[model samples]
Target: MTGNQASAGHLLRLIRTGEATTRGELQEATGLSRSTVGHRLDQLFRAEWLRDRAGISTGGRPSTRLEFDAAHAVVLAAALETRHARLAVFDLAGTVLAERTEPLLLEDGPDKVLVRLAEWFGPLLAEAGTAPGKVCGIGLSVPGPVDWEAGQVVQPPIMPGWDRYPVRRRMREAYAEHVGPVSSDPLPVLLDNDANLMAYAEQRAGFRDCGAFLLVKVSTGIGAGVVVGGEIYRGIDGGAGDIGHIRLPDRTDALCKCGSFGCLAAVASGRALAGQLSALGIPAASGSGVREHLAAGRPEAVRLAREAGRRVGEVLATVVTLLNPGVLMIAGDLAGAPFLTGVRELLYQRAMPRTTANLQVVTSSLGERAGLTGAAAMVVEHLYAPDRADARLAALESVSREPHLSPGPR
Candidate 1:
C-alpha cells in the first residue's frame, strides 16, 4: 500500500471493525510488512486508543486480538422534543452511564434550551462518574429541520425564532463554561432533525440488513425519517422527510403551524387529535396529554387516534410506493395499537401489493431511548472516522487548545 493508504488511521479502522485482528491479518489485508503494521499500531497503543486480548486458537497457536478501547472517551447526547428534553452520558460502546429527562419547551427559544442542556450535562457526567475532559463530542436531536453543514436550524414551523440559530456555537461555549473544559481539543457538537436520528438508531439496532427502512413519527406533529443502506437519507438540504406538510384536499380549512392550511399535520398529528378531544370537553393540550389518555384506554382518544392513523397512512401509501422501503416503523406518541391498526388499514388498502409484500409494519422497539442512542452513535461515528481519528491521535501528543469545526456527517 502507498504511504497515505497505509496510514495508521486506516489500519486502526480495520482493527476497530474486526476486519483485521491479528498481525498476520493486518499484513495480509494492507499488504504491508509485519514490521510496518507494528510501527503504525504502536502509535495507537501510546494514545490508549487500542488494546489487545487473547484470541481463540485456530489450530496450534493462539493469537492476540486487537480492539478499539471504548473507555478512551465518552459522548454526550441530548434529544430535544417540542416540550421536553432527554439527555445522557454514554461510552463509546453506546452504553448509557447516566440519563435524565426534563421539561424544555421550544417556545423558550434556542438560547435558554441550549445553555440549560449544557449546564445539565455537567451534573449528568458527575453522576456517571466520568471526568469532564473525557468527553469527545456532543450530539443534539432537535425537533425541526437542520442544515447539518451550517450547524443551524432551518425555517421550522413549530420552533419559532429558531431559524438559522447558531446552536453549535452556543452549545460549545456553554460547554466550556459549565463543563470546565480543559482538553487540548475543542469538543464538537453535532445536530440533526429528531425523526432522522430516531430512524438512524432503529435501523442500525434492529433492521441493519434491511436495504430500505422508513420511520414515521406521529407525536405533536408528523414527520418521516428514511434510512437507505444503513445511512439517513437526509436529502440535499435536510428537508427530505417533511411529509407532515403534504397538503390534504379535505383539510383546507385546518390551520397548520407552518402558516399554511391543509397540511397533513394539521389533521392527523397528536396535536390535531388532542384538539378534537379538547373540543368535546376532554382535557388534552399536548401529545403527552393525549398519550396519557390513550394509556388509560380512553375510548374517545382511541377513536380519534385511529382516525389520525388512517390519515397519516394515506400519506405513507404514496411514500411507500415511491421509496419501496423494506420496513415501515410507526413511532412517537400516537403509535399505539389503535393507531397502527388504522395505518395498516389504509396503507394496505391504498398501496400497491408489491410495496406491502416485503414490508414489515412495526412500532419503535427502543422506545424513547431511540433518539438519545442515535445521537451518541452519531458522535461516535464522527469522532472515529479515519481522518478525524488521525487528527485526534495527533492532538493527544501536542497540547493545542484550538477549537475545531468538523464537517457534518454525510
Candidate 2:
C-alpha cells in the first residue's frame, strides 16, 4: 500500500507493548500502508517473534490481534549475593523456566565465580530446553556499584579483586566455553548493581505507577537503589545510591570496608549485626546467618536487626524528604517484620509530615528472586527495545540467511 518500507522492529514493538495489536492499528500508528505492515509483520512471524489471534470486531469481520511470542528467545539471569548466587533461565517475558541456587561466594573474586556461572549454564540451558542460539542475552546482578556502560564494577568495598574487572567480556567467553561457541557472537551480557536490579524488578512488578521509588538492601553490606520516573537513577558514575557509606555522627570509630570510619554500614549493616551477635556467643557469621538466627527468633539477632533498621531509617528520613519517593521498599536479609517495624518507627518519626504522608513503606514481594527477575527483564528490554531491536533483527536475519552455518551455544 506504500512505496517506503516500515521497520520490522517498530511493528514488533507496537504489538509487544499492546499499542497497536492489529494490522490496521499498526498501519495507522506508523502511517504505513496495509501492505507495508503485512511485509514487516511477515518478518516477525518468520522469526517466530510474534503470533496472531482473532480480535473482537468493531463493525465488520474480526481482525487478527498480534502478540509478542515470548518463547522466541530466552535470557539467562544471575544474582551474585555476598555469600551465594542465584541463577535462572527466563523467557523474554520474564517467566523463569529454570533456576538454581548455589553457594558461590563473591569474595572468591569475579574470575572464579563467573567461571562457575559459565559451568552452570550448560545444565541450565538443557533443563530449560533452550538452544544456545536461542539465548538473546545474559544479565548479571552483583553486590557492587556497576559502571553499566563498561560492564564492570568500580571500587566495590565487599567484592574483593573485582574493581574494574571486565565482567561482560569474561562472562561471555566463559559462556561460550561451557555452552558452546555459538553463544559467543550474538549473546549479549549486561551487568548491574544487585540493589539496582532488585529495585528495578520490584518496582516494575508492584509499583509501576509510582514515579519515584527507593529500595534499600541490608544484607552483609548495605546499599540503596533509586528509581525515578520509571528508570534507574544511576548517578554520573553509578555511585548514586551508596548510602551504606554515609558517615554517621555517633559511629566515628566504626571501621567500614571502604577503609572509611563512621560509615552507617559499619555500624548497622547485617555484617555489623553478625559481628555483634558473634560477640554475644551466637554463631552468626554472615547476613544469611543473621537471617537464620532471626528466623529462629533469637533475641540478640532480632534486637540487633531492629537497631540496624532504625539506623538505616534515620538516613532514609533525609532521603524521603529529599526524593519524596512514593514507595520506600526495605529488602534483603534484614527486611523482616522486626526490622520493618524499627524502620517505620524512625522513618515516620523523623521525616516531615508531607514526606511521610504519601509514602508507602513496603517489604519485598519478590524475595530472593527479585534480582534474577530484574536481570531477565533488563536483558529483554535492552535487546528488544526500538533502537536496538532492528540491529538484532538484522543479525538474526543474517544468521538465517547462512543456511550452511550452524549456530553454536556460546
Candidate 1: segments with Cα more than 4 A from true spot: 1-4, 182-184, 400-410
Cα displacement (Å) at residue 172, model 2: 1.2
Distance from true location, Cα of 112 in model 1, Å: 0.6
RMSD of 1: 3.6
TM-score of each: 0.95, 0.95
Candidate 1's residue-wise lDDT over 1-410, tens digit each?
45458677888889877898888888988989888899989978877788999999979778998998898778999999889999999988899999999999988999999889988999999999988877888999987898988888999988988999888888889888888763434568899988999999999999999989999998988898899988889999999899999999987999999999999999999889889999999999988899999999999999999988899899999999999999999999998999999999999999999889999999999999999999999888887788887887776645323447422111
Clashes of each: 0, 5
TM-score of 2: 0.95
Error of 1 at 38 (Å): 1.6
Q: Which stretch of 10 consecutive residues in model 2 shows the poorest summed lDDT?
A: 1-10
lDDT of each: 0.89, 0.87
Clashing pairs in 2: 182-408, 182-410, 183-409, 183-410, 184-410
